[model samples]
Target: MTPRRAPAERQRDPERTKAKILEAAKAEFGAKGYAAARVSDIADRAGVNKQLISYYFGGKEGLYNELTASGYRNNSAITDPATPLAEVLRQFVFVGPSDRDAARLFVWENLEDSDVGFDAQREFMQRQVEYMRARQAAGDFPDDLDPGFLLLALISTASAPFAFARVARAATGLDPTSPEFTEAYAEQMTRLVKQLAK
Candidate 1:
């Protein structure tokens, strides 16, 4: 007879399973928008049974929510209120290629406008508004400028490259992931902000 496994060993580890689902979901969703992405694709990427994806995450919507929610947590850390805006912007722009998938997922969600996608997009926008208000109150931004517009401008400068790769390539002649490009872009934005504030 086969030996019985301990209960701890036998029981499914939900955290590990959930993480696997999220990782797969990020890749699949990044490559294919929410409307086009398939649960079987995520399950295949994770090397898990399709039923496991449903069992752990409830469905594609749940998987997408988990990934986007986690992205917010990760991004919020880097943009913490205590961090200098310039430093935060620098890190935000130059944080390397690993974040490309997250960035892609963000762009895809914004383009699709599904319920789960919109929630993530709304949270990001709200955070940007709060950040802009804080910067304005601290005199880091122009007093005469609208905080909302300034925030939108800053976000555009930082994120446009990720969303519009062709434009970024044509104007900068540098890949979005290049260190030189990131540093140059960050410096340019910093100078612009300072000039505007003055």
Candidate 2:
């Protein structure tokens, strides 16, 4: 086995350094929440100079926004009329629960500060609502359903398990964060969407 490299040494490459810092920031913000998270803690977790985060991201808010943007980009895709609603929801369930840390960060955003990525996320969800509206017009979904609420329900369904993974695990004795659980849950999520859209 290759010997483990020191944290500072691990960040030698600039791109690697930036990625490391983002990851560390995600974990820190996930665990401690936005109001309580500290830059020093992030820097220590990343194993880089505290100044490097400022140099790369401008400041904590910058890093947080970047994480929010990239997290949404990484998890969900923009859907069109050709995209199957069930499939889109399946992918969301698949990606959303797998990243427990991101779910935690989302909890922080919702409970502590809802302004973290409001504009961009609203724009993205608006597009989804329009797509859903088209589908409803075409009779693929219920005509009575509000498009925005449909999107919210799907998103919340996927996020709920992970946002409270620890609590669920404690209460149910099953690891909701596990790969097996996510795969099963994704199937259920897709099935539920299919039933709802019928």
Candidate 3:
């Protein structure tokens, strides 16, 4: 007799399966919010068994925490201290992974009052503030501007285009998720930042 297979669903590579589950979870959570999203739905979307999700992530809460870490706000590799802040801002807005769906997930996470590790992002923002301060001290950026406000402006401007993509598309008859729209938006934002320089 031939050896029994472990079942077709269990044949996937572990990393790929984990990634698919996360992607599916993000979509479900984004659309339905955490309160209503179902693990079975995520499994259906991912083409995996629901048991795989629970096995890999310890269920929804653990999966959500992983997502919080994956979002743009928690990304530690995107920043380079040696790179100019303006360039960093541009990359973050345009070239970085377009995590617009994750922005929607953030909305759900916030409304549910889940401990999604907002502090991790705050720590990253604080680093940006320090970077801006250094630039201001060097007479490159505006010295009169508050670093906190500058950091806020940078992140908010970068995130808003994606966060409000549907609204923007509806309001302007343009697809905010499209590269053309995002590139133009980032250019405008970069120009606005440059205008603030001393």
Candidate 4:
């Protein structure tokens, strides 16, 4: 009798496969930045064929765009009006890997002076500025302060530890990415933000 052919690999789960590709892509983009990350490497990391990336994301640019959008989507709660501003600041400090990857991606964009996704970033920040303006009008803070600048300051303060890890560690003698540092810093940031609103 003829030898039986090997069974075909089980069918892939679309959502799970996409998630695996995204997670692997995030790591690759974060470590090497968009300019240097490769589709084949991400595929290898995800244990999927490289063509799956193109099939799912349409290619590297699409993967980068989706990664950027997902970062915002994952942390969209931080901007919810129902959340107190101080709590929002705290949440920003305690955000997970997606935000960290976004921060790294931002650094790479800055280093390369690329404007790949500035419009989307600008639109997001504009909404944030509008929210801050509304908060100022509601007497959450002094109306004399520019809402745009205030929002910028708050974001920078929340993101400083991640974006400036070396300086953060040097200044505080604590690893900026550590739970100890994040917890303490989140509380301090919340207090400071509350003071601003008062």
Candidate 5:
């Protein structure tokens, strides 16, 4: 008698398939922004049928929402305002894998004005702002500086490696994702913010 396959062996690798779809969606969304990205395009890039995207994520909007949610969760996991500012900044800037595609997709979605993913993005940003304010009140940051400005400065420094890698390379002849660069930038920015707060 022929050996029977296990139930798990017969089942599709849902996690792998979902990861592929998400990777494809990240590229398409980053390239086209949410309003212009097409579900068919993501399906094609993932080498899966368009129906599978619908089955797994409902549609393009759902996929975008999932990606945004994942990005927010990743950022939240690393951020802790209670920590010393330099340590917090370092983790935010360089602790994660240097997944440029994922980072670019997140930033692109965040900057776009389209309503498809704005609610979740706005909520995430508001939470961050509130966190910064709380830290300021706790004497972790200076009260004289506006919380919004401090938030933007922190975001810019944390996101610079992703947002300005090309410019950084051309100007500094260094890989933005390199440990040396992240360390130097984190140190410099931390000092700058500390001085500014005085």
Candidate 6:
């Protein structure tokens, strides 16, 4: 096995160290929530000194903020103007394993009644509503439908299978998180959204 790099060498690459810390923070916060997650635990998970987290991110709040911001940015891909809303619905329905942590973080926030990222999240949702309105104006959605309600329904549907995996499995007798199930669900959602547009 190759020898591990020294701490000084690891500290030399700030970007890599910050990335490791952020990744570790995501896991920790997902597993324990912001209030319960400890900075020392994140540092330990990242294999770095606890002080490094403070040095790089100022503290747990800053780390959480960065993760929340990054999550929103990453999810914005579904809002690409060129992609049809049906295809967008399909993409949102297929939440792969890599996205589980972010989903879990959302649940944790809800459970704790935390509003740490409320402003940003609300802004993001408003943008989705605006996107739906634009789609409606473009004739993709019927004028009769309320764009805000449609967005709310779409978000609920997209997040349901992941948020209630055990319920989904019990109801459908299939692993909701499995690729087969998600693919079929995604296709079904895509078809359903297409119908809404017609």
Expressed as tens digits, the lDDT of each residue in 93-171 for candidate 2 is 7665567678788877877855766665676677778878877776667877888888788778878677777876786
Per-model TM-score versus the true fold: 0.86, 0.82, 0.77, 0.86, 0.82, 0.88
Candidate 1 stretches greater than 4 Å from native: 1-12
**Model 5 spans > 4 angstroms off:** 1-8, 95-97
Cα lDDT tens digits, model 6, 19-44, are 99988998899899999999999999
> Model 4, range 6-90, lDDT digits (tens) per residue?
5554556889999999888878887788889999999999999999989998998888788777766666646876566787778
Best TM-score goes to which candidate?
6
lDDT of each: 0.77, 0.79, 0.74, 0.78, 0.78, 0.82
Candidates' RMSD to native = 2.6, 4.6, 3.6, 3.0, 2.8, 2.9
Question: Residue 138 lDDT in model 3?
Answer: 60
lDDT by residue for model 1 (1-198), tens:
999998989887778888888888888898998889999999999878999877877888888887888787777767666655666666766643547777788778878876885676678778877877787777776678887787667766678778887888898899867777777888887776676556
Q: For residues 86-153, could you state the per-residue lDDT of candidate 3 as single tens digits?
A: 77788878643366567667666656765555665567667777777777776557767787887777
Clash totals for all candidate models: 0, 0, 0, 0, 0, 0
TM-score attained by model 1? 0.86
Candidate 6 Cα outliers beyond 4 Å, as residue runs: 1-11
Q: Per-residue lDDT for 1-198 in model 5, tens only?
A: 999999999898989999999999988987778888889999999999999888999988888998878877777755565665656666676643366677677678667866877777788788888777776776766777787788888887678777778987887788887878877877777776666445
**Number of clashes in model 2?**
0
